[model samples]
Target: MPQDGPQPVERELPTDEARDLLGLVRELVQREIRPVAAEEEASCTFPRETFRLLSHSGLLGLPYAEEHGGGGQPYEVYLQVLEELAAARLTVGLGTSVHSLSCHGLAHFGSKEQRTERLPDMLGGGLLGAYCLSEPASGSDAASLRTRAVRDGEDWVLTGTKAWITHGGVADFYTVLARTGEDGPRGITAFLVPADAEGLSAAPPERKMGLNGSPTAQVHFDQVRVPDARRLGEEGQGLTVALSSLDAGRLGIAACAVGLAQAALGEALVYTAQREQFGRPLADFQGLRFTLADMGTQIEAGRALYLAAARRRDAAKPFSRQAAMAKLFCTDAAMRVTTDAVQLLGGYGYTADFPVERYLREAKVLQIVEGTNQIQRMVIARHLAGPESRS
Candidate 1:
């Protein structure tokens, strides 16, 4: 079963391959993702071309092997890509990250035959994926999700609703978590359902505070039929699948938090350098300088935390606590940094004339999604308590 506790791992700097990946990621962010980010966010546009570009760049499958048309990169490299992409555009970065998470169950748990059949399309194809686990009443308490999948001969009949789903309506496929037994965590199981399934439908996008460019909605499954082969692992393993996927997904959110924080810091730095007050630049003010310093420090710490978690994950070590720590620390740092960035920008930061406001908005969601910060703290506390807490 998926532990509600945090992942524990060590912190270390990136290696040569990680540095090289960051370089490539920086180039891609500068050349492709950055320029149109604001416009896309304003219009809530899903960049189909951008996804194609990323796929062509071998980013869509960064953590997978090349035999499946992937980049054959490590989690560290893949996360650097995510960080740069998020720094450029939170929407696109998040979409890509979530797509990667959606693929986790199938990639790590699927049989070789299943991987052969579906991975290529997922890794190289234009279609994106959505992970369906959180229902209206089951946000942080995912084990209580009411969605159900019942055996129907050779297929399974799934019925329930998943709420606050990123790419809910737009995804080509969904990795759904549904109950298959009496109740609780072990009763659940994971399944891959096509978007075109007969009884699957998505509600109109939710009106959200940020990430407007990425559609968030509720997906309804009314007798949606999926083949037995679509099951990700053995029966009664849905919570485990969900938690395993979340360990990876938490890292994605951490990367996003750092990226958002970096963008805010970058904007604040530019504005402080250029905008003059009292015959001097804002950088001359010790108050503003200290704020910038704090932001930078927090961001660096967050980055360090995330990198450590990534390395532990890549090493196949126990990293659940580390992942939770990264998610919590980075997201909280983003909220602080972005808020400070706005303060550094003065009134301009509050307006649409600048991107700081947008970063602040984007930062807010980072705390709420992928298990809220409250949940993260709970996980961390549990991990800190050790095995005795399990008793």
Candidate 2:
């Protein structure tokens, strides 16, 4: 007979502490996340309490500095944790990634006073965060974002609409990028805007095909005033900050994609083995076995690719190209693997009873988020063949 559930992924952790961390994450997923994931996602319920629990457990800040109330884990270990969480629920996994991405500018470029004052609470004080970059008119061409941040002495007045923001309305804070000078990348600047700012509001969450449990909406900033203290890097440095954050964020998305693919593959294994036809289980059929092998291979390869890129990041090496490659390959692999998983399950896969169909729907968004796969290819090509001539 087939094995019970998906087998635990055997990770090559760097230390005992990392192993223990993964163990705790797995336990938490089984007890809190996986059991209710299907139901809550179907109902479009946000797991606020679950995220609070993760904050209390220090899972939300696994890849940041120790002195800042973070877990001080390396990217390799932290990414593995993301993979485990994502396997249980994409909303939780992707939400955690977005939260980390929201923290990037403040943590990396903020003044010492800023880090000392705000980093701790944001990282571990039960607060959640959202990233604001893509606007309604500037999804791929982020440099063209029209959000305006005009200086009014000590405070800046921000006005614009940020589109497709995860945790849009519910987040405690937002990391916002807006134009501060002339048009294009050089004019943009980053800010840490409180969610309750006077003029900041979110539209109704978009009706998405999947990940309904995590809210994605358009956030409007209408003359929202922010103190200069909230500014992240220097004025006109927003694109630099945003690009750096995206390189790391892409790796997080890659890990999530692998986790999602792994989940679908596990479901396929158990269902095919138990469901029988022609006096035999589906596992016995050579055709199905080959499909299983391909799925397993893709998941493993994707995992390795993301991990390799993560290790490069941890080593303080140039990993932008590798990160883009990981994000591109892993997400595409997830789409293929999840689609094959649905096919392997036959009619049952088409129904809501099994989770494969949901996985298939979720996998598609990965290809589009954190810079679409097309963008990833462009980044890689730029690295290899230099930037395209703007003729």
- Candidates in order, TM-scores: namely 0.94, 0.99
| lDDT for each residue of candidate 2 in 89-131, tens digit (9 for 90 to 100) | 9999999999999999999999999999999998899999999
Q: Estimate the overall C-alpha local distance difference test score of candidate 2.
A: 0.95
Model 1 misplaced stretches (Cα beyond 4 Å): 1-20, 387-391
RMSD of each: 6.1, 1.3
Give the Å shift of residue 85 in candidate 2.
Answer: 0.4
- Candidate 2: count the clashes: 0
lDDT of 1 by residue, 179-214 (tens): 999788889999999999999999999988888888
Poorly placed runs, candidate 2 (over 4 Å): 1-4
Where is the poorest 10-residue window by lDDT in model 1? 1-10
Clashes of each: 8, 0
